[model samples]
Target chain A: MICLSLFLSFLQIGLFSFGGGYAAMPLIQEQVVTLHGWLSMETFADLVTISEMTPGPIAVNAATFVGTQTAGFAGAVAATLGCVLPSCLFVTLLAFIYTRCRSLPILQQTLASLRPAVVSMIAKAGLTILISAFFLDGTASLIRENISVRMIVWFAAALFLLRKKKWNPILVMALCGICEAAFCAV
Target chain B: MEIFQKKQRLPVLLRLFTSTLYLSAFTFGGGYVIVTLLKNTFVDKYHWISEEEMLDLTAIAQSAPGAVAVNGAAAVGCRIAGIPGVLASVLGAVIPPMAILSLVSLCYTVFCSNPWISAALNGMKAGVGAVITSVVWDMSSRIVRSKDPANTLILILSFCLCWFGGVNVICIILAAAAFGVLRSLHAKKGGSAA
Candidate 1:
């Protein structure tokens, strides 16, 4: 029953979410934290961070982590399938039909409108992450007093490399890991 | 419609699986990076999909549900072959994360206890935040450069709604879609890119 519920919840996430991975963060959070009580918001943010470190889709990683935490390996399998299978089925149907009517004006307009909102959703996810990463309580308002210099420095370095220099994210992440570990050791 | 031509059943599936798996494993920056790798292999290397078709597929992938990379692979794979191709592509996209995360989950409990490990994980969280910020900046700039005022307004409204108002994302998106349809209808008369 636990595994089945995990699968069904993630399947709903996979089916309903649009836009990109970050865009799906809120939905993932709502389902896991607010709706099911599977994980707390702090743990969800941690999972999101860990998911960011892992390869593959962020949504997939979250589903796997949450599933495993809740019900071990079989839970992981069930959750992953639930998250991906819906997309697989839906996209196949969409692909078959879309290829036939590629240029419908209505479709084009809808896509154009979606682009901006998608961008905003990603930004919202980023804001939530920044707060959680910096603040102790994971609350946006307490960030001023709870700020950690180490986190801010590492974040700035990552941003410069990623935004300005266009460094490889994997390399940046590895470096950030080493820097953080070293900082913590000292 | 002669794209990618005909291939025997088993080999095409194999090829799709291998290519997608290799691409997903090699890239870590998420959907767009995976999309680029797909383009390089399918469009540039194999000539399996035309450049325009790849763009269309990406758009469709974004507009639809699930991860864009998975959707892209399925859409392109379906175009190249058929149902088998979609299976191969999705499996290829999914397998890497499962394997990688399985290994991570094995250590997750152990890693959670150590303070040093926790610090590193927290630092990595910051890095992830930076990466997401950069991604949003890059994507937002492109849309802004499209010179559509409605795009800018929708973008701002969505951000405010999500950040301050705490409105449900799905509701915001639905509202934006309605706004988009109206914006495009108005643009048709004014004659600008919609």
Candidate 2:
């Protein structure tokens, strides 16, 4: 039953997750944290964190992690298949039609409108995660109690290095990890 | 001749599978970044696809649902080898992430509660948040490039709807699609594609 539900839920996510992984974040969050109670909110945030640190698409990683937690390896397979099967089924057909009608005015305009809306969806999902990470604890209160000033400083520095300094992403994440470990040891 | 063609095709499929596996396993940040990596492998390295075809594939892949990286891989695979190509490509994409996440799920929860490990995880969480922030800004800036008042309005409206308005995203997107369909009378209207 658990596996079946996981598969169905992820299938829904895969189908509706337009605008790529980032756009899918909100829907994934709502389903995993709010609707199913499979993972706690903090745990869900942690899932997002680990998902980012690892490779593959966010949606796929999320499904696998949550599935593994809930029902084990078989659950993981079911959930992953759920996430992927929709894409495999649709893209082949959609791409063929889209390629055939590349210049259809309706497609172009729909895409144009979608582009901005996609941006907004990303912003909202990103902001939700950002706020939860930066400002929430077990219970999010506008400003999370556990968020230390040091953590904020480290976050900002890492962002600077990755963005303006153009440092390697792995190195930046490692630096944060090491700094956090060192401070915790004290 | 068909048998000979089958013999010729094996290596092509094998190469597509291995390269996608390598990228899926190694690349991080998000699927969008793989666009460049795919270019390097398929175009620069193997010469399987032309730069223009990659561009077209990427556009179509991006417009479709699912992860861009996965869609991009599937699209390229289809272009290069058809259905078998897609299977090879997608299987490559999922295997690495599945393996890694499974490991994390099995062991990390036990370690996560340790004070030091907890701290590192928290810091990592913060780092992830920062990366997401950068992505949002980057995407938003590009969208605003078209300078369409309607685009800006929709951008704000969608954000407000999703973030504060409590509107379901599917409805917001559908509404935008309908608006576009209705207002598409003037392609000359300056709404540049993001």
Candidate 3:
């Protein structure tokens, strides 16, 4: 039953998570924190950090982490499979059909119509992250108290540097972690 | 002898294994990051496809099922080396992460409750949030480049609906699709009548 639950939970995340892994964060948070009680808010936040630091998609990392926590190796396998199998199956089938349908007008039209919507989904995901970071869950108090000002500044600085220099994300994330630690200690 | 000869027809499985390893090992910053990396390798390095093809592949990968990074790799691989290439690249992308995460999960089970580790991760969360915000900003600018007032409106409305209204994303996607199709049909009719 636990394995089954792991599969279903990840399957839902994999199937519905449209924009990307970051976009899937709230959904995974809801599943692991609210519904399943598998992880605490702090731990979920940590998982997000660790996942980001690691090499794969956050969703895959979260699934693997939560699944292992809930059950074990078997649970990890179930969740990972649940997360990836849907895409694999879909792409494989699409590949088969694409060869035959590449020239079809309706398919082209449908895809063209979907483009803007996909862009919207991506943008909405960004807004969700912004809201969660700055405003959600009474973190407004921290911002009001001026404790979060440095953090915000760091964020903005990092954004500017990243855009201007095209620095490696891993390097940027590491530097942010170091700055965050320094701020907290001070 | 005949069976052995048939078995040697194509090294599909071998190619799949190689491609999967390559993607899984090299992909960083998750899927979006991988998309950029893929463009570098496939377009700039390999000349597997043109810039336009890369953009088109990204669109398809986003709309299709599974991880965008993997989907993009698989499609590109298929384009380059046929069905065998698809198998190779998808497998390459999936396996390493699975192995690494599996190991991390094991270690996490042991150290998840450690206070120092917890504190470090807490600090790291703030950083992760910042990183995600930066990525979103970059991607949003790219997506909203059309300068079309109507597209801008849809983009804003969609963001508001998803972020503030908490509507189901599938519904939002469907609404956008409906709007697009209807608008196109109206335009076509107007063009023909004119």
Which whole-number lDDT from 0 to 100 does residue B76 have in model 3?
A: 63
lDDT of 2 by residue, B28-67 (tens): 5556545545765787677877654565566556666788
Task: Count residue pairs with overlapping backbones in model 2.
Answer: 1
Better candidate by DockQ, 1 or 2: 1
Q: What is the DockQ of each candidate?
A: 0.45, 0.41, 0.30
The sequence of per-residue lDDT tens digits that candidate 2 reaches over residues A1-186 is 999999999999988998776788998998888999999998888888777666788999999999998999999999999988878777676656655675788877776776677667656654654555566463346553565677778889988986898665545666887788898898
Query: What TM value does model 1 have?
Result: 0.68
lDDT of 1 by residue, B96-164 (tens): 887777777778656556777666666766766776677677668877888988888888988998889
Q: Is candidate 1 or candidate 3 better by TM-score?
A: 1
User: What's the lDDT for candidate 1?
Assistant: 0.76
Chain A alone, TM-score for each of the models? 0.60, 0.55, 0.57
Once fitted onto the true fold, the runs of candidate 1 whose alpha carbons sit more than 4 angstroms away are A1-79, A95-99, A142-144, B1-85, B104-108, B187-194
Candidate of highest DockQ = 1
| lDDT pick, better of 1 and 3 | 1
Which 10-residue window of candidate 2 chain B scores lowest in summed lDDT?
B1-10
TM-score of 3: 0.64
TM-score of the B chain in model 3? 0.60
C-alpha lDDT of residue A21 in model 2: 67
TM-score of chain B of each: 0.58, 0.57, 0.60
Error of 2 at B110 (Å): 2.2
